[model samples]
Target chain A: MPMPQVPFDDRGLAYGDGVFETVLLRAGVPVLWDYHYARLLLGCQRLNIPLPSREQLVATWQSPPNAELEILKLILTRGSGGRGYATPDNSQPRLLSRRTPFVVNADRWHEGVNIRICQLRLGHQPLLAGIKHLNRLENVLARQEWNDPAIAEGLLGDADGWLVEATSMNVFWQQAGALFTPPLSQCGVAGTLRAALLDHGVVQEAAIALTAIHQVDRLWVANSVQGVWPVNKLLSETGVVLQSWNPAGHDRLQVVGHELLGYSPTSR
Target chain B: MPMPQVPFDDRGLAYGDGVFETVLLRAGVPVLWDYHYARLLLGCQRLNIPLPSREQLVATWQSPPNAELEILKLILTRGSGGRGYATPDNSQPRLLSRRTPFVVNADRWHEGVNIRICQLRLGHQPLLAGIKHLNRLENVLARQEWNDPAIAEGLLGDADGWLVEATSMNVFWQQAGALFTPPLSQCGVAGTLRAALLDHGVVQEAAIALTAIHQVDRLWVANSVQGVWPVNKLLSETGVVLQSWNPAGHDRLQVVGHELLGYSPTSR
Candidate 1:
């Protein structure tokens, strides 16, 4: 497939004026298409962007695929516009879908990945919260906090010290046999898989704090492409080992994760 | 000049993982080129993007212009990269420069432009507060609040009710005899003209609340391209007029605005 090239004046580039979704593609079929599409539409409505028809999006995905296991990134931007931040009424919405080969460390699934608390705190913006918008510098900066291969993820908290999410994934923990994830009412991208878990009646959304990390029985981070990664050790910015957990319940969670994400960790 | 075409995978579109500078071009020369370049460089440094050399950027600007009075938009994105929020170490920064004809109403200067307080509050993110990075959904949303030609700009405040800036410009108000502009330490774009005003000691950076708007003797919205626009009347979201100014001190501020912005409202 040829790589797509957008006009330089695209509002997506100009102001990050768009929303996006990344779905796992298996055998050229996008996994959890309905959920991704629903969220994409919701985001468009929230931003007042004209929603692209579902048929238009489906037609875009029918193109030939280069990889069996791939990640399909769908970006819906407010197309091109003139100078200034105001949305042009005549501007059409653009659907840009790109396929990239999916790859993840199988070893990390067996041996839980280490995680760290990022120094950068997420800003509270209820309007933009929970929406997978293109304005993701916060996640990018949080991810850049460390370059260690062992540290698979960085946990991000909002300004008020409430844990929000990992840099690119939604975080959940099992405390005394009950599942809990941070409330994303103020900030963080509410991952599709995280919603699936909640819908499946396994995870409950609550206000989890940084201090609560020490009390968790088990911890895991989940995203669409990466599936779920259990956290073996959580570290503070000053290199303090805050919490360490054994991967006792990881296999059981992976089984549920496979059902929700439509991908098995062992296949990776 | 031709419109720039960036690769679809450009991080600017994918994550708004970039920074931009819109410089006013007069007779094919970019106005306040030094300040724009400096801000762009600072933004790049803050975002950890590789800084494009001054010569390279200058060479890009040497392209023959098609418009006499134009707005030159220069976007620097962490070029094309694979999936996820992580910045690719091998990613080369891409520079996109496009020229658009500049046009503004001269009547807006004479009969001061009406402004309104935006319903959308700027989120407080100290990491991204001042630097004009590409993650500007807040500004876009704020700008979309009104389409009335009578209302030239929307004043945005932070989540804490402290006034921040207008949708696309820095705001200044005179209380008694002192000029006060909201501090950008918590939110809002620390605009080029705003910095110049602070550097020239014409505007002092302080916390200005929305309640204090009624007490202001004079109000102005400023940017590099449009210079300064005096506010004749400020309105609430419900269309109720909050503060009406006499525009008595507009000329004085315009003189200082011209000195700092390198352009005059009358000239435009």
Candidate 2:
């Protein structure tokens, strides 16, 4: 395929001035179209980008080679504008879509993953916190904090010492019989899977502190790509420890993944 | 100029995983070349993008232009990578340069710019504070906040009510006997003008509070394009008032116009 053409004045490239969503496609079909669309629309409303119609959106995904799975990226930018910080006078946003091969190691899903607490911290900007805006330097910094063979992911916290989320996923903890997740009102991306879990009555949203994270029986992170990964071991500034085990029906991480993606883990 | 080709997987476009600078070119010469290059190198160090040598950096801008005054946008993206938050393994970043015509109304510079405070607040990320990274949604949001003809540039503050900067420029407040500017340690862009002013012994950097801002006798803003403009009236949450007189070294702002661009306001 020819390289995509974006104007030099594109807000997406210029100011990191846009929002995006990466949806997992199973067998050439977008798995959660409605959920992705809703989140995209919410992002548009928050950033004031024009929301395209559902028909307009789905039409963008052209037929591609038959693959077992794919990754669809939806980018909505504030379009090309005059050379300055002020929004263009007669500006209309651009909506673009592209697809690529998806390759997730199926073995990691079952074996559970190890994560480390990142030294880089996510900032507190309530206005632009929750939505998946393009201003993602924190994620870049967090992801670059460590590059060890053992650490598969890194959890991030705000400057105020509140546990926010993983480098690329929303975090959830099981503590005291209730599922707790960090609220997005302050900071952190509102992941599609996290939203689905909440809307489906799977988890409850609550403020989780950095010190109390060790008390949770099970800790897992969720995003659109990596649906959920149970955090078996957490490495922090203090010390490392294996998370306690829990046995509950739909509350179990294994059961949740099975119900969502129709796959069962080998270890569980 | 033909559009530069960027891969869909390029981290710059994907996650805004990069840094950028827009230098002003006057009579085929870039002003503050050393300062701009230093900032870019510092930003690369902070964002982990490999710093191009000074010769390589200058080579990118070595091109004949159709316009006398041009805006050179230097984009340093963390090149192409697959779906992930981590930096690409042994990946070289993409550095592209494009030139566009520079047009600024001289009248607006001569007369003080009308400004407003934006509803959106910049997040406090100390790690990414001073660098000119690509994650600039806060500026975009603040720029998009108003469409009033009376208001020109908009001021942005951090979540903690600390005075940061404007959408596209660094702000200066002269209270009592000292010239003070907001520190970019936690929020705001460490603008080239701010750095230059400090280097040239124009202003002193300090952590400014919102309550102490009104005490400023004279107010002015500075940027690469528009050098400096004395404030006539400062519209705040409290009320609008005439800015006290303190000759900001330029009564008509033409001194800055000529000093930065080398062309008098009457000439071009």
Candidate 3:
């Protein structure tokens, strides 16, 4: 059966003129609601899209029965309009949500995961930076750089050769036991977990140059769905191990801070 | 009444992972079919999308009754899939077409139009630079820089400060009677009309510096739907005329060369 779809003229589909949030729903509750809502609000404000009230979002969260884990994604866009890039004056914002069963990656969460460097570099646009907008072709193309099952993620650097992020996660690392993550003022999506970690003060924001990737003591990747996972290996596009690490105990602190919703060890 | 919409999971909506073509249909026959098809093919190939055969497009073009001029927009998107940046294996491309009544802009065509320098400097990403992909928020934001009816278009400069193109059209300028346009190697859409003009040996491709805007003798904008339009005045975002041109008879050469799809004096 066909599912309901967004109107073709919807700006979200047409121009990618919208924002989205991917929430980790555990037991029918969207984890990190405050962080996700904050990011969504910021995205809406930046794009000048009238945000839906908090009550509206609360109503959406009430749907579907309690479950162990489900990926709840919400997309908010400038609604249906005629052809042209200029937004319509009376345009209404449309909000859409979907939920999908998420199988926790027990292997990656427990044993750590391998990631690769993407040849595709992110472009700098401060206006659209930090928000998780729909204009994500860079991520799509970066992800295309590797297809090996062993390669769990791809790291993307900005055009200025600063490590921006992993394909779908925020990248963090420790050097001399000092933890830091890339600042996203120029480019890259500001993941909710990254924001929480920064707010939690356990992670400091810094510009990690792409040339210094190999100098890090330990690497970690985090997102709302997968939580924080220690990066076990770094691979080149050709599947060559450029750097290796034993992340078993390295990410223990982040996991122990799981009470903050930034860590999820779904090792079932 | 609601029209059919694209599936929620379509990668085009999700990641802007697709390409599109906006054509002008005259009496139900698509104008510049060859150029449009060629560009579409290139876009599909660049993104690794399977192109619908020419026959399929021709069949689609057969729809709708004969009309003077209607906008024919065809959007090809990677089909529905799960939440992830990776292009799903064996993903099929979905082709969608819509025809919009195009009121001939007789005034702008005959009297020329006003254009502005966009405040938003487009980011540089060579990989997705030239194609008319779904990721068009830059253009969208640039279009939002002005709302005056007198401003027909806004010109975008790249991150390196080169005049890339107009918000929705290819830009051309004549200096000392030598026609030239900015190269799209770094960024900006390669319009079909721009390609045709380049092929016809009328306009030469050149790197146009944003600082050189005042050095141009005359300016023009071109696209498949609107054809060629003389730019009479260049304005700042505040509607201040930074530069002005009396384009009355200067654009006579382009209009006379309507043999190419570059001119459409829709004065009716």
Give the DockQ of candidate 1: 0.86
Residue by residue across B33-116, what tens digits does model 1's lDDT show? 777877887888889998998887887668677776788788899988877778898999998887777775556666678999
**Residue A140 displacement in candidate 2 (angstroms):** 0.9
Ranked by DockQ, the better of candidates 1 and 3 is: 1
Models sorted by DockQ, best on top: 1, 3, 2
How big is the positional error of residue A222 in model 3, measured in Å on the Cα after superposition? 1.1
Kindly report the root-mean-square deviation of model 1 from the true structure over all alpha carbons.
2.1
Q: Individual DockQ of the candidates?
A: 0.86, 0.70, 0.79
Worst ten in a row by lDDT for model 1 chain A? A259-268
Q: On residues A1-268, what C-alpha lDDT tens digit does candidate 1 reach at each position?
A: 6888789878998889999998888878888787788788779988999988878888766877678788888889999988889889889988888777776655777777899999999998998999999999999999999998778899999999999999998998988788889888889998888887778888898887886778888899888788778889999998789989887543556667777766654542
Over 4 Å off in model 3, which ranges?
Answer: A250-253, A262-268, B64-66, B250-253, B262-268
Say which candidate scores most in DockQ. 1
**Deviation in Å, model 2, residue B11 alpha carbon:** 1.2
**Whole-model lDDT per candidate:** 0.84, 0.75, 0.83
**TM-score-sorted candidate list, best first:** 1, 3, 2
